[model samples]
Target: MKVQKFIASNMIEAMKKIRQELGENAVILNSKQISTARMFGLLKKKQIEVIAAVEPQPKMKDVRVKEKRKPLSRTEKKPNVRNQSLTSSVYPADEKELNNQIEELKDMVQKLSEHSSPDEYKYYPIPVQTFLDHLRKQGINGMIMGEINAKLLNDWRSENREKTEQEVYQSGFQHLKELLAGVEYGGSQFQKKFINLVGPTGVGKTTTLAKMAAQAVLEKRKKIAFITTDTYRIAAIEQLKTYSSILNVPVEVVYKREDFQKAIKKFTDYDLVFIDTAGRNYRELQYIEELKKVIDFSQDIETFLTLSLTMKEGDLADIIQSFDDIKVDQFIFTKLDETATYGSMINLIFRNRIGVAYVTDGQDVPDDIQKASAETIVKRLLKGLGV
Candidate 1:
């Protein structure tokens, strides 16, 4: 393997350098953002550093075939020869074409082998391989994959012959379930008198809140009231009011901290009070601080951080980290239908040590939401793609 490090002002330039020097087959091993200090550490410029490697090509084998015909005399007939090298002149054009085809075939096979699992993984049983492939296709993280692989290997080694495929599947499913254990599950229980939904913009916070409120009113037979701090968008407040009218529930629009407290006071007689917060770009610290000013975290309220499955995992992670100050109670994942991968839910649950309360699949109010659970998440992760 030939390895090289490349540093550039940005990732695009670094990748271009790698592709130029290492061909399109080069694999990126790692990349990171670094800063270079200049002028006695007074100023710094951010840059991207990348490590890439390519496998060495194999040597072509030489095969000699002897002919039975007599050798030609020097004066007989000299074959035409131009500026071409001796080796190139000896081989026919068809032979050169065949060699090129063989080289390309070898390159493709080498790339496939390199992309496959390591040699150690080959020792595992077929059932384990199936589950791992399913998990990988579901976009599960490598850390979680390693953990699951280790458990499956250990289980196989302990009772290798006694376990059936079904048993293996069950064990694998249980392993995943155990990882998400001890965290809260199910839809909003309305355990707290005040329920606050907070998340980034366009994550369907208002619609999800409305769904929970509808569930509370119809199924739980609880008197629910709506309080929205999303006064920045008139359409959002109006949307909430529309749902409020349909459910015959009272809705209050609050702007400042005092308004929030007053709305809670007014809904004292109601069984559950749902608060819809502003859904703007809360990835910034100022928005989180603004949320803190209006919503009272000290009060007995359950704050559910709404997230969209369609967003990238890194962005979702950043959003989750940004809300650390607000002390989110649990997560509510939206747009499940928009994305096939559900690993982000598991990733967030295990990494952040937080629980998931609900998952919304569509824009339909109170129709597409489901209570989140370990089994439900595991099923979604392994759905259609078998164990």
Candidate 2:
């Protein structure tokens, strides 16, 4: 038997090399992953190694005799004792093991061919791998990563274009921008009279609301007022009051639906009325129901769900789902500086089909808060990656 070893970036390619060099009948003896060229133990590259062997052709007479063998009847005795010794010699224990290994390798090849054919990402270029690692660090969802890899590879191959590393990076950035298209990002126009901020506790909902109010009053020169349904939290109410005092905007503390209506009437002449709701443990259904009792969602209002970028993606997804019945129109991500990964925001935006209105990196009132946009978000996601 002739034995040879093959290596490639992935299993599919390794098999291809094996078949090309050793002929179609080559048997894969073993396969494993390996890493090579370690640079200061940081930049090792991954590779796949496959061990293959091609057996020598047996005599035609022996092949024909083996093919002609038939099953013995119950009345027939076992093979002749003399033939048994010859048979044992012809098929030794080691040969039997090798044949079993060959059968297993054949199965592996079959399965790989069925699943990995037409897979372009099996040979991802260095640039693509670098970007992929950066995204993985940003906590981007695995499914999204897979999707980007597949689409990027397909496009790269179909275009038949020789793109430089910079070009590849730009293409990835552009693809992200396309995914975030049709999303409304920025300060609320307040086309509707009421703009409501809602979310769980400590997500900086009150602070974000304050930032929005500041933008509307100082930059847009619009008459604005505050109506908060967060009477449950004295600190929240007090916080809004402080912002209200600073902006010289009138704020009404509402406890019930009637109180909310009265507050709206009181701020009827204002250009914008920002409503803040009490943060609750949204995992409980009663809190959402209590929200319906205290806030009037029936009014012409745009509700922005405030979320923290530091929150885990699973928890963030659960929080958004908890408000599914509440008609959340958009999102406002806060605490951007607390976490390096901004992938949670992107995941929320795409999965919820909602756009981001604002993002706050710190507690510097309006200065920390900026109008969210695709360009800004993608930059945050790829910030330190040098992509």
Candidate 3:
């Protein structure tokens, strides 16, 4: 390896010098900033420092190099050519030792996975289990494939139609359905109540409100009024307004305490009042508490906690813990289009007794959200598809 040090006024200059001297196959090992001072001179700006290396051969292209004066002899003599080398050969270990270390790593991974939160396991169940038995039964790749399928099968079972059936998708689907049995909304039973949407940022509350509103208006023919408290986002009010405009529905924006009271009062004749909330970070319970204070006395309000399917499973508990102060009667999920993996929706649903009411996919108004049925949710979840 050709190791060298390059200094410049800034990062781009330093990187240019490294590449120009070391050629395209350069690796950055470290970086630091050092001040330049002269004995007589007062001071100079801090110089950008870089440590770089070039492999034996020219292994990369499309590289930007700095201008460094080369020795006249270098123009006559060709640059030495050799195979590219990295840190790979610096600490070569015995094959047996490598195997033992690998085994140890696999064990550690499996143990970490076992102690993983229900949410942790939800997102990476198969991959976590696969690392443990990689050498025992099949190659690592084979282990990965098998474990992933097993995980998918289990997820599908949660949403399956029949609980007893052994079919892969059916079983996973069934499991999901059973997990959501608690908060399942039996339509028309409480058609005359207020449903609230609350969750961390970017979980699609406004869109969900439109979905429920559309269902109530078009399908149930129930008089629906949309209410929103999300006035933070620069275009938040406009987004909800857009949804309302397309749906041919009325939307009420409530900023102060009085506005909220008035909206609820205005919607008294409506069958359903779908309330959209701002997505906040779960860690900020103060805002949540403030929100609770804002809407605490609302009559017959059923609050739903919305979460993103793309979030890692481990964060779910943190989310629940943060939102605990606020009353969550049910849960809603949005951004299903962003996730390829279905994590612990079942675990959360079952453990929290929160049934999913709607799922929002895209940004399309009144089109992205859907009523989550046990059968459909199960079928898609088993396929490892986001619903």
Candidate 4:
């Protein structure tokens, strides 16, 4: 069986090259993506697959000897299947396996086709209001924001409600810009480096800590430590412990207000310290009060209130409003991979102006986060498929 491989920027291009070189009968033995050389330090990768022949032809016997030896009778030439008891069951199983593989390949091909999808393909896309509001992120001005957002809502609803890819995206950006106009990232840079990441249930504060710690150690090469006030959740302390192990960083688990100062002192020699707090229902004043006590005790530390974009925009507001009583310095957006689109953060940053310190796209630790910026925010928002 013949085998070959091909690579291209996307699956469509890869398939075209495959057809040109390997012919239509070629069967794909395997397919995957691999990194392309970096362009200006950005990650660039492409799809590729190795294809092989689908079937093998039976080998011929000595044709010349057979022709010369006989007029060999057909009965002698063919195997006596009755005596041989030919293996027939395997053929059926082979056919079944082939069909199953074909279905799997079709799914893979569909995924490849979707990766480079253009604007012509969305259904029930994000609302234009949410879109406009997401744009003017973190004090992005109003009039220019308004001009960009001009008539987008009406246009989206009237002209392209069902299938308007570009129109929807354009209007969506404008909608989100407006949301960004009100919030401020209360800068805590002038304050201490001990920043506590606080958010709702399962917002991934521990994992986010790993990302921040990794950046500090690997990029800044600074002495770093961790402190977790999240003794409530099962294995929560253990999770931070794992990061501490990988990073060779130290951690302190503070369960009481008095232990907090002692905990801070232990990590005080480090250049940076990340604190993970227990996820609490912000609306519950009692829980907030308890958390406030911890923050109050850890008063020297800066704090960032995290919000997961998976939340509806309205929930984001209630979360911020509930936590408003705390001195939130910045924001951290988590679980970006769960949502199909994430236009809401633009508004969140604007509403808060607390600089967005980090965004976690997945649970992949340091691989998922980067320092946040306005350009990064706008670019990713435009590329709404992931965190």
Question: Which one wins on lDDT?
Answer: 1
Tell me each candidate's TM-score.
Answer: 0.70, 0.70, 0.54, 0.54
Give the runs in model 1 whose Cα sits over 4 Å from its true position: 1-123, 160-165
Top-down lDDT ranking: 1, 2, 4, 3
**Superior by lDDT: candidate 1 or candidate 2:** 1
**Cα lDDT of model 2 by residue, 256-331, tens digit:** 9889888888887888999998888887778999999888888988999898877778888888888989988779
Candidate 4, backbone clash total: 30
lDDT (CA) per prediction = 0.81, 0.79, 0.61, 0.64
Residue range 160-255, candidate 1, lDDT tens digits: 275777777888899999988999888776778989999999999999998998889889999889999998999999999999999998999888
**Model 2 ranges with Cα > 4 A deviation:** 1-123, 158-162
Q: What is the C-alpha RMSD of each candidate to the true structure, in Å?
A: 12.1, 11.7, 19.2, 18.9
CA shift at 340, candidate 4, in angstroms? 1.2
Q: Can you write out model 3's per-residue Cα lDDT over 62-144, one digit (the tens) per residue?
A: 12132243475845965433542532323234534654654565455445456333321222334332222321122213333
lDDT of 4 by residue, 29-110 (tens): 6655466757786865543454534333323343223433225676667645577532332234465576577667656655
Deviation of model 2 at 42, angstroms: 48
Worst-scoring 10-residue span by lDDT in model 3: 131-140
